[model samples]
Target chain A: MTTTLTASKEQSCQTLLASGHTACTGCGEALAAKLVLGAAGSNVIVTDATGCLEVFTTRFPQSSWEVPFIHSLFENSAAVASGIEAALKSLGRQNEAKVIAQGGDGGTADIGLQALSGMLERGHDILYVCYDNEAYMNTGVQRSGLTPFDCMTTTSPYGEFSWGNKHNKKDMPGIAAAHNIPYVATASVSFPKDIENKVKKALSITGPKYLQIHSPCPLGWRSNPQLTITVARLAVQTGLYPIFEMENGKITKVRKVSTPKTPVEEYLKIQGRFAHLFKSPDGNEEIRKIQEIADRNIEKYGLA
Target chain B: MRLDLGAIAKAGTSKANQTCGWRNFKPIFHQEKCVGCGLCKIYCPEGCVTMVEKKKYTVDYTYCKGCGICAEECSSSDIEMVVEEK
Candidate 1:
């Protein structure tokens, strides 16, 4: 049962997502897209939102996708995917290809929320993936609904009067699971195998599924491009980004953090977005606040 | 009567657009020192790293953005990022 995605080192492998796109150097979204598509295999249809993922992959007469990919507006990819799924069902060929709708955090947790919720509520046989890099990376770094609390961005810049965003990060996976869908999972780019496994598991189950990947953005996050994997790994180790799977409105699995849990500073120090927290007089207080969030996650998921 | 959608592109035509010009650094694969971990193949955002054989890997420069991820993540440090001299 060796596919091109899971092909071992000795086997010849064919990636469904081709190379030579215009994504920023070491873009985590692009890497996650490749990993997801590879896991989905060639028999899948992808509908993309107008974000970095779509903008970079499809440029006029060039497309990095080897399989069928459709793009329209930023807020309607999930709707479009629903229509595609219905079309496949109407034609009695639903098994021919798996349907995937993808978007950035801005497109998913903000603008496209309505369509996504509709798709999930309607129980459409599709997989919706949100490549959450925290901010709107493509159209300059702006604060998004999924952006973490006290994170610096263009719209939520830290200043003498402000401490980054005033809102806490939206629990997207929890919202998706609240719909009582068949599956909802969170993964990070650090663990490519986790992503591959979750994608396969979500696709294997029927009905609507949602997968949110914590893809690290080097440019937007102001982190080192070469340390994209390192940043993603540290995020999970710090308990800032909990990896887990939910089935039938219940958490079925969780990736536990090893003993001597990594503090939030180790995760925050790598990204320039959190740099203001260390230099400002109110920085330590905010850092403590962030550590509380991680602590809550560790307690909630038993990731100690 | 007739539907007029926008222009259509062929599948995987992005391969035709060589991205090697974007690279300031080139990742040189030292096959002799390779440990066959396949970490480079998994981490490359460009998907340019390919496993040539067990304990061997090759990167396609034509599409390599030279982000240095492969070199930075190589298990055996078999992949080195060198300044691409014109």
Candidate 2:
């Protein structure tokens, strides 16, 4: 079943994401970035960290970016963005241009954390978007800080005694807000309008803004690629990815789940990473732990 | 003894471009019945809220942006949004 999403009220999704990229079928990361760029429009400079989104979208000699895009090291997208913004400011062209930093889970949550923190602390006039697919998909799906506990990755494979990742995903949004930036938000590909609206708002705002976007990776997660958007939608439904925004280091708004929150199992069962959580006797205990984490998140976010 | 006030003087809104309508005020607290779970403190995005005492908390209004999270997450209906000032 193909979903015909209505064009965003502010921008069109069609040409922004465009067609003929190298992304695997149903890549949520690509969709998320595409919609964001579409909303951002032209006159924007994007700095991308090396990851699935970067490798898949841009091939040497062939490019898919409709706007000015720069490819940077695995952990320097934020710093690169800082430079871009500085150049724009130095030339007194700040008002005419906008800056964005893009990366995956590893680039944003792990390897790139330092640069990301520096960029935020310095309060550069740029927007940083982390397309979180949980693992470092570009690097063969290894576990990353954003990887949820008990989820299986290439590095954290499930076994008779092992339950895969042991730690919960790091709270990057909180870390970003710690820098005292102007705006920060958590969004999902499921909510295009919200993400688009946030991007538009961030474009206008000075200072730094961080957006953690929940994208779904099918190849890495052992799920159907077509379910990319659906998986992201369920993530919010399950209360795993709460849609909220923080301003000046305080929670300003949070979007509530529709009710009768989707069971954690419903989300886990769809992805191969969590398949072991239910199938094995030892996995059940880990599953319980994972469920508790989700419950805690629901309570913490008031998503009931 | 020379004090370079340049850093402080140049640190108004110019170093950082202040955005408009970027923040919304949402007061979140269980005013009377708060158990002071402090869960909000743990999950607060900015970590700006602090516990005044037992079962009591105060938001550093100077930094609070009114996310309404304390009210939403508080099991008790004690946390609520009150628009006082920016």
The TM-score of candidate 2 is 0.75
Off by over 4 Å in 1: A1-13, B1-3
lDDT by residue (tens digit), candidate 2, B1-86: 99653211111111122111223545656458876555444323223456777777766554343445445445566777665444
RMSD of 1: 2.9
Tell me the alpha-carbon RMSD of every candidate: 2.9, 18.0
Interface RMSD of each: 2.3, 18.1
> lDDT tens string, model 1, A1-304?
1112333632222477889889888899999998898788889999998899999989989999999999999999999999999999999999899999999999999999999999999999999999999999999999999999989999999899988998999999998888999999999987877888899899999999999999999998999898898889888988999999999988899988856878899989989999999996679999999999999999998878
Best by DockQ: 1
Q: Candidate 2 - CAPRI tier?
A: incorrect
User: Model 2: per-residue lDDT, tens digit, A8-103?
Assistant: 232344334333445554567766887688679877888899998777656554456767788869999999999999998999998988899999
For model 1, the docking class works out as medium
Error of 2 at B70 (Å): 38
Chain B TM-score in each of the candidates:
0.91, 0.61
Best by TM-score, which number? Answer: 1
